[model samples]
Target chain A: MEKELKKIEKVISNLELNSQAQIQELLKNFLKTHLKKSKIDNFIGDYPTFIEPVYLNVNVKIGDDVLLGPNVYIGKNTEIKNYVEISNSIIFDNALIGENVKLNNCIIGKNTLLNCENINIDNCVLVGNVKTKEDVYRIMYKFK
Target chain B: MSEKRKQEIQRIKELESINLARDEIRDLVIDTKKEVEKDNDLLAAQINDELNKRGIKSIDIVGAIGAGKTAILEKITEKLSKKYRILVICGDITTRVDADRIEKHNAETVQINTGRECALNAYHINQVIKNKDLFDFDLIFVENVGNLICPSDFKLGTDKRITVVSITEGEWVIEKHPMLFKMSDIAVINKIDLLERLGTNIDKMIKDACGFNPDIKVITTSAKTGENIDTLIEALEL
Candidate 1:
């Protein structure tokens, strides 16, 4: 687990980390390294919490047990699944959020998905039409 | 006289006639604008006197679309509605979105749909005052149509005129719309939360505004964050 974390850190340090694509790559690697330690099960049954007021820029469907943090803006037609945590981020239109996901300080672009369970993301912006966990892995592998 | 000499004279006469006509048209345009301004000023003075007699304070808020003009008004309304009986006259090209928003805060609202008009002129406010019994209201806020150019040209008979400019519109916004800043009593630099993220120098913008209108009062605020909203109310003395 330490070796995997070191590799993820090395990947993040090597990339030109200004753009959203690089941030997404970093988040994916971080999540993959953490997932290997079987932390996914520990995040289950955690109730969603909102630390600050959530601004709904458009009609957004937020399922039960979703935790929205301060200064979070959810665009129209976005669906946040159950037991998801989002904070200080902007989720654009038509994006799908799978259950048991954690997002912090990230921007989720239109029509994207964070379908992976028990993932924690911070200071990242996921762009393009990211649909599945395999897609995230593929992008992260390219960065590596 | 010779035929060639007569032709030259005729040409000169026609050129002189065209110049005279052009000068007359220019003078007519200038005179017409002056007359309109004079009439507007007269009406504005009348409205001001009327409001003063009734012990009502009035202010006109002007800014570009998405410059947080409505949001600033909403914030002001939320804060002032508890103490003052306020009337908000929202000027829009079509919808009553702003008026409806202010009404939600328990303020009396009147929507003036100025279709194809860029600003609310003195006549519009005059008509509304004539139609409504405004004696009960302590304050009146006339939200001009969302345009920086035309709204500055027309005085809506308010005691104070405020122009809201947001940092998200970029640093050159103040320099681009100097006329609005020159005519306004106060200039509000809004959306300060995006100042660092947008890499905008709020001080520079304030300096440019002062250069445009040295007497203009400048305030920085973020309506979304409810920052400096109380200071704005205090500046307005409402």
Candidate 2:
């Protein structure tokens, strides 16, 4: 397993990573080669609708009126605000999915803050870890 | 003061001294060439010869601001470091921000703060190679000062040249900047992951790029999502 992980890292290190779709594909390929089936165990939040098979790592907070996925993976300590929709997407660690944001076929990067409202993002990769609040807000709004 | 802090201060002082020495060399070069014709072709040939003699392959990564030039360099350095020794020369107006980012991936970097100069020239490369030992590295990635205009006019004598244009810059970029594409060996149409959101016709962009230079290889990539990076590596033959 350690050797496999190292091999995966080596492959990832060689590629320019900017899109979540690419990472998703890489992981899927890795899983296909190694493990037969992958499983996710987590508690879903109240009144937050799930399309089923939604994966959440530990400490992921989902808010009311939020719609999660048929294929969604939220990483550790990420907070999802009200009226947000996410499907077929991967949100990395320490991310804040702002209110009224709709995401599909995308990947939200680590330490990213989505501070905007009423924006629809699809087929995009938001490479977070922005230095300032202004930058975070700026990018969140740029997708529209 | 803390030991770490003292060491950092000393490191900064050494950097300042090195920068000063480089500046003196640049000034000397400029003064010596004042009487001579400003022949870029001659200088480019000289740089090419120097690089060839050292058996080093050089790539010039040219792009506008926010076109993911630094991000691409970071990935390239990370991926290729094990196989080959890599040095990234980051050219910027006044900041080492790009160099600092690349160095975090454990890549050797040299920052050329080209104040008042929009493009990196052969003279800068000549001085850099003269100051540093080129035999140490197998590959050199020169991140040209961010802009599509000025860099087209200047040749840095690299083996391969890649021009990165993002979707955020719009479809007209390739049409507007034809000369850069004409001179480039590869044209990277970056930020394809934003195709849906930006409503950009990536096909037309690719077509336009290929139209400008029939031989220029066009690769669509997203630096944020890590899309088509392997293909790009293959395209570069790295």
Which portions of model 2 miss their true places by more than 4 Å?
A: A1-144, B1-38
Model 1, span A22-119: residue lDDT tens = 65554444443333211111122233333222445445666665655434556667878887877555566677778777776666666776666666
Model 2 native-contact share: 0.00
TM-score versus the correct structure, for each prediction: 0.56, 0.53
- What DockQ results do all the predictions give, each relative to the true complex? 0.01, 0.01
Spell out the clash pairs found in candidate 2.
Answer: A14-B79, A17-B226, A18-B223, A18-B224, A18-B225, A18-B226, A19-B224, A19-B225, A19-B226
Error of 2 at A101 (Å): 60
Q: Which of the CAPRI classes, incorrect, acceptable, medium or high, describes model 2?
A: incorrect
Candidate 1 Cα errors over 4 Å, as ranges: A1-144, B1-24
Whole-model alpha-carbon lDDT for candidate 2: 0.75
- Top model by lDDT, which number? 2
| Total residue pair clashes for candidate 2 | 9
